[model samples]
Target: MPSLEVIDEHIVLDILSSTVRLVGSLLPNNIEVVLHDLRNPECSVVEISSPSITGRKKGDSVISGARRDPAFANLMEFSSEPITYVLNYETQDNAGNPLRSSSAIYRNAQGMPFAALCINADYQQIDKAIALIQQLTASELNPTFKKEQQVIISEPTPDNIDALLQEIIDIAMEQNPGSNRPAIKKANLVAVQRMQERGIFIIKGGVEKAAKALGVSRYTVYNYLDELKAQNEGE
Candidate 1:
């Protein structure tokens, strides 16, 4: 008998492609499945199932949907494992309908991400149906049956990588505002710390973009990161 062998990346991707189709067919039609080739960001999507949910097709970029999510992008950096994932995040479709999303990153033997699997499930219709049922069955005197609906919507995907970086920098600056010189230095340090936590510095040119945004040199950003590491270790 032959033992299981480590297959090549292409073969693994092919298997995932079939899995995508099978999973999509078995799941509710509102759920979408997609396989992304991380090496080719420009045309990352290699397979898609139930495209109606998000309208994603083959040869599409992963810049949209869960890929732009900061938590999803930074999962690999926070985890030492070769496989990492983020789940049950809130997102929206192109038409602004609410969706529950999840994503997993697949790495090659070298621990570099080569592909990603993403799922988006639209439950807007289901919510509407539930609301109607509640309205119909609820007693006129009992107020407890009429529950308020709360939906959490994630930020929309940026148009490009530059836009994503800019948004991250803007958010960091907003969180650490300053006016005076000393306050500004502390603000910059806090801003860099926030950016690093969100994995902004992981991408190429991220340090340069952040430095420009924070009005500091690239070396200053590096110093900030080192200081942050030291502080974390001290704690």
Candidate 2:
């Protein structure tokens, strides 16, 4: 079976290639996708190139050679959301001379992102043409609007667990915060009730371990067991 990374890379490459071809046909320059794994210590997964961007080939890890580029580093760090930016004035061209460019980042569903799309617009000619058109019209020309880049950080929390037994206690306490009652007692009661329903307390070492895991005292666990026994006897 092919690795998940390989499959994901192929899918992303195909999508990026189709987009590049579709958009490049309408525009003068080409677009490209550069993939890097942010979760796995900056491993290059794939690279889809355009005719305009020289030297970069598919499957060639660009970072291995050009690790010093801040744009690439920033793309890796800020891959959680789409970010658009204009290259700094001092940024160099393929010929090592200064050139202007734009770039964007895209993230995946798991909040792990590693793709960037960059385009080098022909600004000199476009600016000149726009200026000429401005002379013909009496209306004032408005400056081009650039979108601001936003960074979203997602931290892993305990609530991310699927079968979070402690979540019920947390929610119950939240729903009744000012009751002046002990939250630990409420949690203990809830845990005991659940254990009775599930018959998990019958298993050896389960009750003690569960109590320790849930940050409750052993005495509380024994008390819950006793209450459960009393309730069963009454029933």
Tell me the TM-score of model 2. 0.35
| lDDT (tens digit, per residue) of candidate 2 on 84-195 | 3436322333343333555555555443454556654334445656866665453344345333444533211222112334544465456545445475566557655644
Give candidate 2 misplaced runs (Cα > 4 Å).
1-12, 29-52, 64-68, 78-90, 121-235
Query: Which pairs of residues collide in model 1?
Result: none
lDDT of 2: 0.47
Looking at model 2, how many pairs of residues clash? 0
Q: List residue ranges in candidate 1 displaced over 4 A.
A: 1-8, 41-43, 50-104, 119-128, 139-154, 171-235
| TM-score against truth, every candidate | 0.57, 0.35
Error of 1 at 105 (Å): 3.9
